[model samples]
Target: MNLALLFEDDFVSADRAVLTGRRLAHLNSVLKVSEGDLVPVGLVNGDIGTGLVVGLSDTEVVLQVELSEPPPSPLPLTLVLAMPRPKMFRRVLQTCASLGVKDIWLINAYKVEKSFWQTPWLSEENLRENKVLGLEQARDTLMPRVHIRKLFKPFVEDELPALLHNTRALVAHPGTDTPCPTHINEPATLCIGPEGGFTAYEVDKLVEAGCEAVHLGRRILRVETAVPVLVSRLFDACN
Candidate 1:
């Protein structure tokens, strides 16, 4: 972990926090920190700063924190993605958080397996755990919001139009005529399908909901790889 992400429960007082579990292990084994050392820390959904190690032991570490700096600006992009395989999905969540994607939609596509949603990684606790790893990796404190929509048609027809308001909407599909735009300054809503890509009817629904179908060249990439590439291409801040 690049930054120790402290939740409200970690705080003993306004300026003091306690570290245990994975973070304490990281301090003792990875960092080999002494009582006087300072480490990077950020409060969840709060500010970035440093923590001074005022107390240390095998089981816990006590920190005096001072938060002053704001976290990095979040990307003005809402990612609408097909649910990926469970193993890959966790990594994608981390990558999205690391890349500053604050809005994420995991929608089902024709190719997406029903079993994918049953994975324990989608559980509330696991979801927060993975997102925390991502935030810590990026030294960011603002948490990303994940919205799950299992019914594709209802989501596209009933909700997607409202999400497209005041944002450029694009669906990344292979063999499309329009190439994906680069370094866009405007907010964008990007839809990416499953491994085999979205079925024709699903693509039509998304397009009808106001997304322009665009291509990322002829090469096929896994969902995990495509997300970062697409985000970097669409936003100058990501690059």
Candidate 2:
């Protein structure tokens, strides 16, 4: 927990805030902080700053905070992803957040298992929790938005065109002729597939929707590994 992520409810007054739940435990155990100590803090979708610990107890910790600096600039990228396995989804989601990706679309692909969407991690509460973990890890505060589209064809035909507007759009497919471009450092929409990757028909739909199919050499990277690798390759982080 590089930053203690603050929400509106965490504030008692304009300058005062309280921490409880997992954060409180992190304070007592991991951070081992006490009164008069300075702790890193940031408000969700707000600014990054510091907090002076004014009070502490087993239940909660109180701090007086000042927020001035803006959070890291969001990456100008939109991630269109095929729903990964349940075990990999959380990691992929966090990687996207840590890398400053603010827009995400989790769409269905032919290779994606229906069971993947049934994972509780897709729940609003759980999604926020994982995103918070990512934000805190990256010392960032701006929350990323996740859009779920279970129907692949409808999403590609009816929605993806607008989403790709004014952006460099690419889909990562193994064995594609074009290697994924590096350091574009501009607004881009990238589509990545499931463990086995998108089938030929699925890739065709995405390509038809203004995406250029690209590859990461001959290596087939897992969704979790590919997300960060591709994002870093495509953009300068938080610059």
lDDT of 1 by residue, 159-182 (tens): 999999999999999988999999
**Candidate models: Cα lDDT each:** 0.95, 0.93
Cα lDDT for residue 124, model 1?
Answer: 92
Best by lDDT: 1
RMSD of 1: 0.8
Kindly report which residue stretches of model 1 are placed more than 4 angstroms away from their true locations once superposed. none
List RMSD in Å for every model shown. 0.8, 0.8
CA error at residue 72 for candidate 1, angstroms: 0.2
TM-score per candidate, in order? 0.98, 0.98
Each model's total of backbone clashes: 0, 0
Q: In candidate 2, which residue ranges exceed 4 Å CA deviation?
A: none
